[model samples]
Target: MSKVSASRAFRRRVSLCLLSSAASLGLSAPALAQEATALPDIDIDSTAGRDSAPATAERIDRSDLRARQTGSSDTAKLLQSVPGVSGYSAGGFSTLPAIRGLEAQRLGITVDGVTIASACPNDMNPPLSYTDPQTISSIGVITGVSPMSLGGDSIGGIIAVETAPPQFAQTGETLLTGEASAFYRSNGDGFGGALSLIVASDTLSLTYNGSYTQAENFEGGGPLGIVRSSEFAKTDHSLNLAAQTDIGLFELKGGYHFSPYEGFPNQYMDMTSNKSWFVNGHYAGAFDWGDLDVRGHYRKTDHEMNFLDDKGGTADGGMPMNTQVRQAGYDVKADILLGEAGTLRIGNEFQHQWLNDYWPPVAGSMMMGPNPYINVNGAKRDRLGTFIEWEKSWESGVTLIAGVRNDQVWMNTGDVAPYGTGMMQMADMMAAAAFNAADHRRHDSNWSGSALLRYDLSDMVTVELGYARKTRSPNIYERYTWGRGSMSSRMIGWFGDGNGYVGNLDLKPEKADTLSAALTLRDGGEEGWSFKVAPYHTRVTDYIDVVKLQDFTDMMGMPTGFVQLQFANQDAEIYGVDASGSVPLWSDERFGKGRLSAKASWLRGRNESDGAPLYHQMPLSGTVSLEHKLDGFETRIDLTWAADKNRVDPTRNEPRTAGYALLDAQIAYSWKNYRFTLAAENLFDKAYSAPLGGMSLGDYNATGVLRPVPGRGRSINAGFGVKF
Candidate 1:
């Protein structure tokens, strides 16, 4: 025991395990209010039928981010009206989200807790494209029972995005703020703008923000008009710094992003180039034996893809690709205050990832038979996590939360060669003998847990219950992709679904068990009226499915009967329900108020080994609205619906969607700090298709039959903003 006495005996065993679990539950410590108000280095905005939070958490404030900021900056389409969300359109700004049906590395995206990695291995740079929905101030979602200190690994759920914090100025004050906004849309003659700035004193602060977007080619209503490659462009920037005293708050941030072009009429490449950078640091404090936090981040990316101009240009039989990634992470936490009812949080986290995927040869290429073709050449992954959480409350209204987590993942790869010539060099020598007979270093160790309860049966009701045990490991392109036979599988495409994938180096590590429930009804000044209903169920075990492989081969080795997929381990189940409400249909003060709202979601999945049907599930959906206000004007109208996805999977032939309805409208106005908006989206141009919008690889209609990828035609948007 040297090394500074083993780091002072591990901080005295974590301060005696947080003071013996808060003095054996007789708690204490809730009386320190001498100018206190600083807790936002990260706070997952709790509120989903509140009663002290977590009823499958959901929160999106700032007037729902100013009513969705009038059309796409693609923060996952602003969570697609949020009720178990769904999305998967790879252009006009990269929409990808999916929860309740899981998606992409099984969902656990963050920002401001920073975890961002996706330099397109067919993901087109998702992770909400490194955030920039006008510098999001709030957005949270946790559908499904996520806990274990806000989800680790993942079982599909958790999205957090935050920014906007750091303001201090008084006592010999000095502050200066700014904001600006602009927007326009009309079926892809799109436009965008955003900016923000701030400066402060009374403990230093500074910030700068930016955004830009562009679009073209998007018109789809009847006869499948336009829609060619569904164009796009993007840019983002950030910088921040902060410092505050009396022992707390410190921050630093930096960011940059760029996109030279983007387009992906549903898969098989398109996204010319993307570049990224990031840096982060944070700290928060309140001690006396309690609250402390720290964070760190780093990111880098470079992505590229090709084949557009309706999927066959870029000359010489096209098919370009490139990817690069590097990510880093850190987190540390403590929040011990147990007395007037409990609170204890302990954390540690670490992440590291590196990647590479290549392809570039040309010069008399016939279909990429002899290019550079390395495809995920030196992959790596590492994760280490720890968590422990507990919360309590009593006085007979219940409320409890519990958590536990542990993770250790490691993956490695290197050494793989064989590139093109006859029959693509015998298909890269059988994919380098199956990547040298697999086991290119792998490891996994996981454990997770969660529990929640909340009760309050009066003052207009509340109830909640939850349970969980989640884990997911097996990403590194699902445990390494090593092409074979005819060579498809460029790291198992992430649901832009025009299929072609392979990966499975003895994959395993996906375990889940969940149960959840919620019910809430309110009226007693929490608002005029409200309602909620949540339900969930899950059961998975080694479920990393994606079968469909009746024989394949493409990319010049020929044979393509067009079905290829691989990544196995089965047995699964999923269930869901979600509902929402709001009411208040009239008011006075010279009659200027009204309201009504609704939401719905439904889900089902199976493949509990042969029960089939669990590929891209998400059908039954709903939304409705009507609103009005006065004194600064406001209005709304909405109606969205869906149902008719005949549950198809049949070995990933999955296609069957028919059911649609949509209509939208909005208006707003404000004075003083200024605001203005106008929206209309798809009001009547209906030619629907969106069951997770997949399929359809580049242009065709008038019954050419490669359908399922429509929706987007009647638009009318506008925006405005100001602040000073």
Candidate 2:
């Protein structure tokens, strides 16, 4: 058999060793649950048809776009209410969420309707991972099937974050509100506050938010401990202004975020230092023909890193690494109703980035020199895109939705500074290669399309099914960036070199074929409960994975463990279901007062080529919460558990992590316009890797990404807020 075939066979055998460990369970613990106003269902058809029925009453508050906090914790925690979703953790701040079985760039994130580019090398800045849960008022997670205005993508899903509309002071009332809040736990501490003031007569409003956080290394609860230097801190701020007038609404916003050291949860790259800022303007107006919307946005981020080629003798000898990246981009979009039940969303987006990379020479670095060097003098990327979508609901509640998007991108890598000067040698080779090749500016184009149909059986029930063809073109990192990843932190010994991994410009786009179905229910408007279940499976073609290169030799003439890895295309499959609902304990119409709410989700993936489990198939997880409110004070306790996952691909050494549970309790007291809150996570001190199978990498590198990072122990966080 060929070398690649042999490799596949070996991995298959290894995967078979743990196949029996795959367990199964019911869709969810309980089926029916109703409370919390059925979460104010969204009227997807409202924007589609100008003649739609008064735009189906909005069940959720839209002005609630600001100063509202839910899920009291991480992004995954806050999104638990959404069906068909789950998340896994590689570190304290790193949360990798799986929609069905898809992840990475396959998922899209938008803030206040503008796409905010992510700079994380390991796919870590998922929507929830970017901002604190308290920073926004309302959140919507669209799994697999999303609106066309969003460019109609994500085999994994799309996340939309919106700040509440400005609430001007009443006609005769002056408004003033400010509050301080803080959170601390076994792993970290954070504090922040928001303030808002408004004058009634002019219909003008102002708001501002600021926060700071600091944390130490989190413990990885494993038999062989994984020591982590994730100790880090940062600050964030945002300002907003809005005015309501007879013609329309106008708003402006500016935001800033900075971090000195942000650990990489992906085990491949880390940000030793970072800063980002953004500004935006928006206008919305309504008329008899339809609603008109327009927006202009600009954003930029600078990233710097300190890297070590490898740890734990995984390489011939560890090498030092470094990088600096600054990206600035601007985009514009307009949404105008077409007529009746048709609306067109058209937009253009573009960006230009400048990259400055450096790699200092090592005292005894090998490669034909006493001290060899590699780095990019500079690099650039340009992109443009336009897209549109439509929606319509027929009589008897049958709805149809469709959308399409096309995007074009261009990238250029610059020259070397007179050869052998530190980190400049690679430039000469790059320019030569580009000059000899047909294309130095690697160009790519991607197209996406999707269709979904839903039939409302009754006022209390709805069933929907959908299919989508989507493609996520490789970003700049996947196409260029010579030598290795930022900081040389990503050392994979499996490839035999342990030198670390690098990006490839010749890589192809990753695409997905998806099919899904969703069932939703609620008892109408009368003392009813809400429940929804969604199941989807995606076949990823040309899925990207880091292929490692290892075969280094030590001075003794024997094989050494160092390795290098690069992105490549492969096939994979993801399947799973999400079920969640609120179980009421008391009814103002029935009991005096009592309540119960719970949610559960499961995600699984397999390498289609060999049927091996993917690296991070989020474990079967569930949460149960009970709450009680007395007058103005409310208290709740939650229990969350995940099942065992030993079925893993041998390549990644997926482990056999035992199942574990955690207790999270909270208390909130409120009076007048003030609210006090407290929350706890991993309260029992139980420790286990969410994806324990990841630990196997440690065998190759003493400091491998698989080093078991600790799950947090018992911890408590408290905060307070006031709404004017």
TM-score for all models, in order of appearance: 0.33, 0.78
lDDT of 1 by residue, 454-530 (tens): 88887688888988888989887766766654434633576756667777778888988889898988894644898
lDDT of each: 0.75, 0.54
Q: Write the per-residue lDDT of candidate 2 for residues 395-465, one digit (tens) a residue.
A: 77887777787767677776422124245345334533553353547777878777777888888788888
lDDT score, candidate 2: 0.54
TM-score attained by model 2: 0.78
Most accurate candidate by lDDT: 1
Clashing pairs in 1: 27-339, 28-339
